[model samples]
Target: MKKYFNRFPHAVRGITYATGNDFGFRTQVYLGLVVAFIVFAIYSPLSLFEFLFILLGWFLILITELQNSALEIALDQLHPELHDSIGRSKDMAAGAVLLAGLFLTIVLIALLLSRLI
Candidate 1:
């Protein structure tokens, strides 16, 4: 248990570093919070299932952004000089983010449709 507990600070530090250094990550977090607020405000009595689905969608976006940002940061640090391959690698990471965003969009659309029905 102690060994497991030690990881939290490291995780927090990484999250803090990303929050400070990555604009896209920061924007997504803030936007997610705002969107969540709007959703709950609009639908005040949200069901547990709906709430969990929204949370999962938002977390999926964050997880992808973190993974993308970590990869880009590591690649940039290891190879500061510009190269075509590095550029492609970064693009692929960004593509992952795009795919995640699309997934969240689909989740939102599904939620909306379910509510409408």
Candidate 2:
């Protein structure tokens, strides 16, 4: 438990570094906030839990992206060569984020349409 608590700082520092240095990460953060606000403002009255689910999905994608970025940076530092396995690993991580985003987008569109109708 103590070890895990101690490691929290490092994880937070990594997230901070990524948020500051990665343009894509920053864009996603901004977009997530916007989507979150829109969801809460428009959907909360109907279903707070559903709005929370959407926010959770957004956080999940952002977390996965940060982890992916960390892994790619570590792999690059270890060896900058065009390694096939490393590339595949990075791509798979990115694919997770893409899939999550696609699902979330569909959910948002459906929810918004339902709300309007």
- Which runs of model 2 end up more than 4 angstroms from their true locations? 41-46
Q: Would you give me the overall lDDT of model 1?
A: 0.87
Best by lDDT: 1
TM-score of each: 0.89, 0.84
Residue 1 C-alpha lDDT in model 2 = 91
Local accuracy of candidate 1 as per-residue lDDT tens digits, 1-117:
999999999999989988998998998999999988988887778889888888888888888899889998899899999999999999988898888788778877887787889
Computed on alpha carbons, the lDDT of every model, listed in order, comes to: 0.87, 0.83
Model 2: what TM-score? 0.84
